[model samples]
Target: MERTESNGPVTVPALPSLEPIRLVDRHGRRTAEPVVPSPDHDTLMALLRGMVIGRRFDRQASALARQGGLAVYPSSYGQEACQVAGALALAEQDWLFPTYRDSVALLTRGVDPIEVLTLLRGDWHSGYDPRPHRCAPQCTPLASNASHAVGLTYAARRKGEETAALVLMGDGATSEGDAHEAYNFAAVWNAPVVFLVQNNGWAISVPVEKQTRAPTLAHKAVGYGMPGYHVDGNDAAAVYAVVSRALAEARSGGGPVLIEARTYRLDPHTNSDAPQRYRRDAEVAYWRDRDPVSRLEALLRAEGAAGDADLARFADEAERVAADVRKRLAEADDPDPEDLFAHVYASIPPSLAHQRADLRDELREG
Candidate 1:
């Protein structure tokens, strides 16, 4: 499809700029492509291990929230591949701006899962420092972080820095004005940022059909003079390949690329949501059958990537990681109340200072 913007007409060819690479299907069928080589046995094993660890972390967070250990919890259960692949695909220099649902991706990318939990537990302003990790705290406002990412990219490019930015959001987030505005600015200014949208079929309770009339979210990239590609989010390898190529292209001076990952959110939107209230059991069942981890496992087994003993060892390793994570979190220090006051203002204004003093006085009196 061709789209005409302010500059001129931009045409989208019949095929995607990056070819669709798939190793396995929902039904467990193998593809004919020259298998872009799975991560070496050990690497693939680590990825699988990471996936399990991520899921276990999600489970623990949910359980903690239910037990009143946290104020809220957003689960990244089914969207693991999209998060993990995109995060892992980035270069060390690239920046990541993620929404609340990207903890799994952040963890897979080396951001400690315990730190992420600390933020979710309402104990910190951010999970970790942005300078060291090149990752920002999770943005709660849908699609708003895209603009922040675009601004960072613009600044980096202005300073002649060769770094790219990757921002993630949901399909529903695409409907927000900031999302389109960010894209337009990124395109016009030639910012090096990639928008990765995980279209999990629903934006909360609203179905994708209601989010927009567009056939696919990726097609929206045409309006901004960038290439867009749609890929099976369940296929981690394929997601990794496409995103890695897009990141490379962006870093090489190409402008932004929008990637729409076709996947399903296998869990409720959050701990407070009840999927049964609005979604059907059969529909959820259908997606469960297409679960990404199981599909990838099938491919690995069919290809004889690992034997039963190897699988046992990998499983044990994942368990060990999960246990260690639990222990670390158990020892995680609670956030200090004074930390909030200290960071509220580098140099507090008189009016704010008075309010803080009043609050402290009230606390002391009570």
Candidate 2:
């Protein structure tokens, strides 16, 4: 853990910290692993690739939104490690409830890349089916997904299914009343679910300092009779280990775990907002310098696990994937307006039925 010899605010290195596991320091140094061994070359490399691909995809989505190809996109640039690590920790049969900013997690859970893009393009219902993929649609209404996750887990328990339901949301979500209610349900029933809050320090420019006065987001779990763990969201290995342990506890009927992954959002909340309106230039530069991709790359290079050629290949693959997304998105159709009314109920009510008929008539006449 090297220190920056400056009078400025000292940045904490990733190593020798128990609370927040940092296998790779921000300066591209590895922290000593006395008890747990470091992840092998292949595993670490795969995690790095996932983060790279996710960051590239997020950037591409933002660009597409700007180019009028996407309706809106919530970029998940800096939070890739948290998303990928948490989702990858789960078993294939486990359920996932993700937010709009959780593309990295969904992708890690074996979701088809193009299918997610189509959902963002407003071309489908349920994104990809949850029945087969074990991953739910991207829940947009903040902490509402927490309730759904608890319900799903309860159903699974009733069915004697050996699975856990993991739900992802932002720190801003914790302030919602729905989140609290969902926590209550999970604690009372001892449902197999893990509530993962990616504390990215800002909710569309509303900094975490203003979001809540809680000492730590993880501490909130104690009120719900669940244990909480805080992990470094920028460190993929740490994120994986923490989330994986939580998943195991949940699967073994130890109730829910609330994991607050401390990280920073390296981009604006969306393509439309200017982050500069609220945050400082120095803060942005500080986090950008500690790029998650670079940290992993340095570790890989030092271990002789990756060479220049490997890095180049990774960049090339990211570019190819981004290009294909754009090409396919251009040709994708906009979602049908009527499709929205179709999924809300088992059968349409009389009022909505009449409205649908009127909508159809208007479309035909137009």
Question: Which candidate gets the maximum lDDT versus the true structure?
Answer: 2
lDDT by residue (1-366, candidate 1, tens digit) is 777889888665343434345756776556776345555555555556667677777777777778767778888888878887888888999999999988888887788767787778888777687777799778989999999999998999889998998999999899999998999999988788999999998889999988787778887887677888888888777777778888888888888889888888877898999989889999888878878777767767777875688667767866776677667767767665556568677788898877778878887898
lDDT of 1 at 351: 86
Clashing pairs in 2: none
Weakest ten-residue segment in model 1 by summed lDDT: 12-21
lDDT at residue 273 of model 1 (Cα atoms)? 94
Model 2 lDDT, residue 356, Cα = 92
Query: Mind sharing the TM-score for model 2?
Result: 0.87
TM-score (all chains, Cα) for each model: 0.88, 0.87
lDDT (Cα, tens digit) per residue for candidate 2, span 220-300: 887776777777778887777778877888898888888888888888897788999999999988878877788888988
lDDT of all predictions, in order shown? 0.80, 0.82
The Cα RMSD of model 2 versus the native structure comes to: 8.3
